[model samples]
Target: MEQVTTVGIDLAKRVFALHGADGAGRAVLRRTLRRDQVMEAVAALPPCVIGMEAGSGAHEWARRFRTLGHTPKLMAAKFVAPYRRNGKNDGNDAEAICEAVSRPGMRFVPIKSLEQQALLSLHRVRQGFIAERTGTINRLRGLLTEFGVVLPLRSVIVRRDASKAAEALPGLARRAIDDLLAHLRVLDERIAAYDRELEAQARGCEPAQRLMKIRGVGTLSALAIVATVGDARDFKSGRQFAAWLGLTPRQHSSGGKSRLGHITKRGDAYLRCLLVQGARSVLHTATRHADRMSRWVQGVETRRGYHRALVAIASKNARIAWALLSRNEELRIE
Candidate 1:
C-alpha cells in the first residue's frame, strides 16, 4: 500500500473506523479497530495528518495523536457532512472527514488542553444543576396552582410561598411537593457551590480576569468563555470570533444583492446564551454610563430597537473578548 499521509477516524465507543489516503489523495488503507487496538494502530503508523469530528473523545484523541508527531485536526460534524458521498455509515463518514480536513478553506476546531476540558466539565455540571433546579421550581409552581394556590414566577417567591402553601395541602400531595422542594434545595446548594468554584477559577485565571473587566462580563461568563475558547489566535479577527459564537447575523444573498436575517445560531449555544445574557445586562445599564461603548449601545438601541441592540452589544463584546484573548491585553473602556 502507498504510504498513508492523511487519515480520518470515525470514533465510536467500542469500535473505530479509519480511512487513509496518500499524498495524491488516493485511498491507501481502510481499517476498523476495537477501542483497545486504536492507540497501538495509530502509534505504529508514520506521523501524518489525522482528522476527526470534534465530538466526545475527539479532543483527548487529538492530544494523544499529537504526541505521536501527527497533526490532528478536528472539524465540526456539520462541516464534514457536506463531503459525505454515500449513506451515513462509519466508512463514508471517515472518508468525508479525510476529504474535509484536506480542504484549504475548511475550518477546524482548536484542540482543547486538559485544563480547558476540566473547566468545561465543571461548567457543564453546574449548568445541569441549574436546569434541574428550574424544572423543580416549575413543577412546584404547577402543583401549587392545582391546589388553588398560584405561586409567583420568581424563584425566591416560589420557594417561600410554595412551602407555606404546601402545608395546607392534603397528605399525599403535600408529600410530593415537599420532596420536590427538598430536591430544589439540594440543587440550589450545589449550584451555589459551583458558582463559588467558578468565581474562584475566574479570579485565578488571568485571561478570565481580563474578560471580567468588560462591563457585562461576570464570573461565570468570563470563566465559560476562557474555558471554551482555547486559543483566540486561531481566529484571525474579533469579527470572525463573534461569528463563531453565532452573534453575527445570518446572510442570504444572491444576484449581487445582500439579505441578512437573525443570528445563524451556530457554534456553542451555551456560550452564545451567556453572551446574550451579558449583553442584556449591559443594555439595562447603558443609560447610567457615558462611555463610548455605552453611547454606541444607546445609539444602536435608538435606531435598531431593543433586542437588536442587545445582539449588537453581544457581538461587540465577543469581538472585544477576542482582541483581549489574542493580544493578551486588558480592556480599556473609553
Candidate 2:
C-alpha cells in the first residue's frame, strides 16, 4: 500500500470511519473500525497527519492521536461540509474531512486542554441552572399575578415577598407557589455555589486574574474568557479575536459598495453574552466617568444608540482581552 500521508476520521460512539490518502492525494485506504479497534488501526500506520471534525469527543481523540506520534488537526464540521460530493454518511464524511484537511487555507479548531474543557463544562451547567431558575421565577410571578399579587422584578424581592403574596391566594395556589419558591431557593443556592467555584478557579488562574483587572469584567466573565480562548496567539489581532467572538458586524460587500449588518453572532454565545452584559454594566455609568474609553462609549451611544454602543464596547473589550493574553500583559486602564 502507498504510504498513508494523511488520514481523516469520522468519529462515533461505536464505530469510526477512516480515509487515508497518499502524498499525491490519491486514496490508499478506506475502512471502518470499531471504537476499541480505532487506536489499534491507527497504530498500524506510519506516523501521518490525522484530521477529525470538531465535536464532543474530537479534542480527546486529537490528544490521543498526538500521543500516538501523529499530527492531529481538528476542523470545524462546517468547513468540511463543502467537500462532500455524495450523500452524507460516515464514509462520505470521512472522505470530505480528508479532502478538507488537505486544503492549504482550511481553518482548524484549537484542541482544548482537559482543564479548559472542565471550566467550560462548569459554565455550561451554571448557564442551564440560571435558565431554569429564571423559568421558575417567571412561573412563580405568573401564578401570583393570577391572584392579583404582583411582586417586584428583583429576585431578592420576589423571594422575600412571595410568602406574603401567597397568603392572599387560594389554598391550592398558595401551596403551588410555596413549592415553586422552595425550588427557586434551591436553584439560587446551586447557582451561588457554582459562582463561588468559578470565582475560586479564576483567582487561581493567572490569565483569568489578569482579565479581571479590566473594567466591566468580573470573575465569571474573566473565567469564561480564559476558559474559552486558551491561546490568544491563535488569532492574528484583537479585531480577529473579537470577530471570532461574533462581536463584530457582519459584512456583505458586492462590487465597490460595502454593506455591514448586525453582529455575525458566529461563535460562542455564552462568551459573547458575558462580554455584552459586562458592557451594559459599564454603559450604565459610562457618562459618570471622564476616561477615554468611557468618553468614546458615550460618543458612540449618542451617534449609534445605546444598544449599538453596548455591542461596540463588548467588541472593544474582547479585543483588549486578546491583546492582554497574546502579549502576556494585564489590561492597561487609561
Candidate 3:
C-alpha cells in the first residue's frame, strides 16, 4: 500500500474512518473499521504518524498507537475543520485530519495518562453534582415563592427557613418540599465527599502541594490545574498556558492595527471558573494582606472594575501556576 507514511482517523463510538497517505501526500488507503477492528487494522500498517481530533477516547487511542510503534498526534477539531474541502462526512473528516496533521506548524494536544484522566473524571462528576444541587435549590426556592414564602439567598438560610416555613403549609406542599430538602442534603454529602477525595489526592501530589502554596489557589484549583495541564513545559510560556485556559483577550486586527476584545474563553470552562472564583476570594480579602500580589490586585480593582480585575488576577495566577509547574519551584511572595 505504498508504505503509508501518515494516517488520520475519524473516531466514533462504533465506527472509525481511516485515511492513509504516502510520503508525497498521495492517498494510499481509505477504509472504515468497527471499534473492535481499529487496533488490529493499525497494527497491520507500517509505523507511521497517526492523527485524530482531540475528543473523547482520543488520548487512550493515542497511547495504544504508541505501543504499536506509531507516532500519534491529536489536533483541535476546529483546526482540522478548516482543512475540509467538502461537506462533512467521516471520510472527508479523516482526510482533513490527515492534511492538518501534516502541517509544519500545527499544534497538538498532549496525550493524558490514565491517572490524569481519572482526576479529570472526578472533577467532572463533582461538577455535575454541583449543577444538580443548584437546580434543586432553585426549584425549592421557586416552590416556596409560589406558596407566598420568601427565603434568603444563602443556601443554609434557605434550607433552614424553608424547613420551618413548610410546617405552616398544606400537607402535600410540605411533603414535596421535604423530599427536595432531603435530596439537597444528599447532594451536599456527595459534594463534600468528592471534595475530601480531591483533597487527599492533592495532598499526595507534590506539584499540587506546591501549587497550593500560591495565594488564591486552594486544593481544588491546585489539583485541577495539575491534572488539566499535565506538563506546563508543553506550553512555551505562562501566557501561552493562560491562553490555553482561555484567560487571554481575543484579538481583532486589520491593516496593521490591532484591537483586543473580551477574553477568548476558549478552553476548560470548569478550570477557568475555578481560577476566577479563587481570584474573587483573593480580591475580597486583598485588603487584609499587604503583599505585592494583594497590592497589585487592589490597584487593578480600583482602576478597572471588579469583573476585569477578577479576570486579570485569574490570568496572572494561571501564568504563575505555569511558572511553578514548569520550573518545579515554589512560589515566592515578593
Candidate 4:
C-alpha cells in the first residue's frame, strides 16, 4: 500500500520538496519533484491527505491532487509560520506545512480557479497603468504651471487642453509640453484598451453581473469579487467574507468583555482599496438615499468624520456583498 497518509508539498518555480507521513504522522517519504513530476508521484501513492500553501497556481495543483483521490488542503502562509522550527529551506517548509494542516481549528484558504487568476492579472496590470497615468498627469500639470500656462481645474480639462496649452507656451516649454503629451496619449490608449478587455470579461460571468447589482460595486468590484472567491460556498456566511477582507473592526478581548479596535487591515489590500473607493463614489454620486445602512453611515460620519465614515461604509459594503453572493441574494441600493 506504501501507506502514505499525509503529505506536505513545498511548491516553487521549478523544484518542489515533499514530505510524506504515515497514519501515525511519522515521516515515511521524502523526495524532490520537478514541476512535471508532481502529479504522477502523488498519484502513485495510496489516497492520502495533502497540504500546500495558498498562492500562485495553488488551486490548479489542489484540483489535480483531488482528482487523483487525495484530500488536499490549502493553508494560509501566516497560519503555517508557527510550525517552522529553525533554518528555512524547502524541506523545513514542507514539514511546517504538514504540521499546520493537521491543526483542528485552523482556517484554510479557498483555492482559486484559473479563470479567477487570469481576471485578477488583468486588474493588477490595469491598476499599474492607471497609477502611471495619474503620475504623468500630475507631472504635466506642474511643469506647465512653471512655464506660465495653467490648465483648468479638472483632470478631463487638463487632458483635453494640453495641446492648446502647448501652442501658447514659448519654444523650450513647448517642446517639453509636446513630449509630456506624447506620454499621456500612450497611457490613455493603454488604459482604454485594458478597460475594454475587462468589460469583455465581466459580461461573460454571472458572478460579476450579480455583484454589479450593489450600489458601489461596479465593473471592477464585480470582477474582483468573482475572481477572488472561487467558491462562495466555502464561506459559512457573508460576515466571514467581510472579516476576511479586514473590513470589520479588530478584536481586543479579555475576560467576559470584548472590545474591538480599528480594522485589522489584513487580506487583499488592493481589493479593500477598490471597495472603499467604490463606497466613496456611491456616497457622492447616488441621488436618492434613505435607508438603514445609509442612515447608519450618515450618523457615523457626523460623529467620527469622513475618513472613518468611508471605512465603515466599506466594511458594511463588504458584508452586504458576502450576504448577496453566499445566499444568492440580490443587492438593493440603499
Leading candidate by TM-score: 1
Whole-structure CA lDDT of model 2: 0.91
Residue 12 local lDDT, model 2: 95
lDDT of 1 by residue, 20-69 (tens): 99999999989999999998999988989999999999999999999999
lDDT tens digits by residue: candidate 3, 105-146: 998887898999999999999999999999999999999999
Quote the positional error of residue 180 for candidate 2 in Å.
1.3
TM-score for model 2? 0.94
Off by over 4 Å in 4: 138-154, 157-177, 255-257, 285-288, 332-334
Worst 10 residues of 2 by lDDT: 144-153
Q: Can you rank all candidates by TM-score, best first?
A: 1, 3, 2, 4
Best-fitting candidate, scored by lDDT: 3
Can you write out model 2's per-residue Cα lDDT over 31-140, one digit (the tens) per residue?
99999999999988999999999987999899898899999998888889999999999999999999999999887777888899999999999999999999998898
* Poorly placed runs, candidate 2 (over 4 Å): 145-153, 168-172
The lDDT, on a scale of 0 to 1, for candidate 4 is 0.84
Residue 62 displacement in candidate 4 (angstroms): 2.4
- State how far residue 55 of model 1 sits from its true place (Å): 0.9
